[model samples]
Target: MRGIIDLNSDELPKIQDKNGALKRPPAGKAAVENLKIDAAILRQSLVAQAGAEIIIYKDPTEAVSTGVLGDVVMMSKQSYFETFEAAPFALVADGGEVTVTPLPINRAAIHVDATGGLQTASGIYGLRFEFSRATLKSYPSIEDAIMHAVVQGLARTGDAVLTAGIMAATPAAFSLAAAAAAGVRMSELRGLVGTAGHGAAIDNNGVLRAAGIAAELSPDLSATIVGSFARSAVMIRSDVEVVVDRTNIDGSLAVTAWAGLQALLPDTTRFWTVAA
Candidate 1:
């Protein structure tokens, strides 16, 4: 028979036997109960997930210009990892067969055993944009005001990126009438375009006069908006929090995107800069 212990003794009850050793419980019952306190502390030790959003807008005028200026290729991250190769030279001959040996000296060096064989060379250039980052912050304010500022800021940033990229890629695409001058004469711009074999029409203020190309030489300055989105992982949470016993509301938005200048032909696309 098992010995029974008194519950009202001065000593606390023990789960062990007389030897002060622990006694095993029944099968699977030997595990201790998990203590889950339902009580909430009065301190502000709680953290709520942040709620922030981001939006992007492109300029309408620039959006329409893409068609005539160039081609804008939307590239995935995987595609961006790949390298761009250009074939600048090819050999052709009138003979039935020809042997060609490429000299290691320079790109222009090519040895051909057959006469009347012609080696034509063209330029091939690779282009890619470096990664960039932008951020916008808003403090506690009217919801409408905060939204307005954010939208405007996003549009301005996008426009600037697109403009800079285009200008960098094709510096000669548009000739500046004068440095540090606004409102250039239409006639001067026309003459410059004509000399370049581009039939671009310009307004009095040197703006592209049309959204479509009037001639083969003219590039349309119109553009279209491409993909734009907020980076959720980098966006800050929009929420009210107490810091140093003061209540404050703050939020931020982060974005990553690619702005491309559209062109009819990728091979013909030139990403160069000319001195002002």
Candidate 2:
């Protein structure tokens, strides 16, 4: 076996620049052992994505009482006490009807503790919730074309054909066989949901079919499938932005990694602005 005993370390430069400016290089053992950041590299570190700007404070009691802060806020604000069925998610609208606001001291003769009051007035607050990995690209203006290929290729060869067909459809559809298969093999995925959440399926095909109710899949559950597979499949909410994480600032909301990417078409679809 070839060994590293005689390799020359002097030829290796501290950093290398490709197309951009000379930037900070990754830290090495020497710098890490010394508990030091290479100042030379720190100065040129590149930012990945812009951070959100909303900040929100929740009632600790409510946060602990309910499994979700977003749901608690919705129930308290909307005046509903029913248990949530679907997983909780939130959206920080841009100062509109559903704008974020501080909790009032009193509501319907009920007094809210000052400590747990909404921080909208005192400061900014943002909403947060969990998102499926399949929907991660829903917000960004990128095509799943590349990701679709990578994910499909990594799966069975038939998955590549299924993915291509789905992507081509107006509202993509996955056959029952495909959906069941994806759900089963979901454990083996690396580049998509499985990798992001560690064996989490994120229910990509199932969720997408559920969301495509009015389009790709017939809303009438009785609709028959004449495609490659038999049996109609269930649908998930595609356009629904599951609030994963958020911070609110003075009424403005900063959302965290909301899952799912909106469709790439731009020809006046109803789900366009809503998803955007």
Candidate 3:
């Protein structure tokens, strides 16, 4: 005859103090003797299941200028990450639908490209999607798997666009105003005649339009800067003369300018000459 040992409340004191001062265990037997206590399960079994994620938001600011005086337009964006699942796994899932709302762009709004299969905004910078799970494939159905991938792709794509957009606006230092007269003081060379720079002036005629360029700096000075006029008609300040006889005797060229002046030009020209 097979018999099982029972460890009931009688054997494993379920009640508290005689006066019931101590709390009582669940009003049930302790455990079944036939059932073994699995130490491996206590060690390996995931106590909880959770999916943690992080997201970032980037927004580029626009530039507004009036001639030579203008703000160094840059893409300004709100950048931050949202993490899901902290304590109880329910926190992340509690929010039914995760909506990614793109910032409004009256001109060319940033949109998602599903066919692109998760590319970074501007196609540069580091934007990636990470999934963590006890067992990778836990989705109940194929549709669910695709849906998850889509969501992650959208999230990563949005982050890439925003991050790249904002980074694209990071302020840059200016270089030598090429058209400035050779002997002119770098300080006096305020507005540049280059395609870039805050006060950098360019009066390219209908060429930009003809080339399909919008013919204007982006709101944040972050859009494509047209070099159409760079080759043909780009002329520097009248005082600045192009020198055919000039040659770098030192076999090197370095720029020296104030921070303010640097801010007005391209970053490639921020370096200055060490006082020889």
The TM-score leader among the candidates is: 1
Write the residue-wise lDDT of candidate 3 on 10-61 in tens digits: 1222223345444322222232222111211111111100011221212335
lDDT of each: 0.23, 0.23, 0.24
Superposed by TM-score, candidate 1 places the C-alpha of residue 94 at a distance from the truth, in angstroms, of 9.8
The residue-level lDDT of candidate 1 at 128 comes to: 21
> Per-residue CA lDDT of candidate 1, range 1-276, in tens?
112111112122223445555543222223233211111000100110111111111111222224666765432121001112323355756664545544422111111112212123211111222211222222122222322233223223323333333344443433343311323233212111222333345556655432221111212223211111110111111111111111223322222222211111111122212221
How do the residues 129-204 of candidate 2 rate in per-residue lDDT, one tens digit apiece? 3344344445342222222222222122222222222234433233334435433232211121111122222254
For every candidate, C-alpha RMSD to the true structure in Å: 29.7, 23.8, 32.9
Give the local distance difference test score of model 1. Answer: 0.23
User: Model 1 — TM-score against the truth?
Assistant: 0.22
The CA lDDT at 64 in model 2 is 26
Off by over 4 Å in 3: 1-140, 171-276
In candidate 1 the C-alpha lDDT for residue 18 amounts to 53
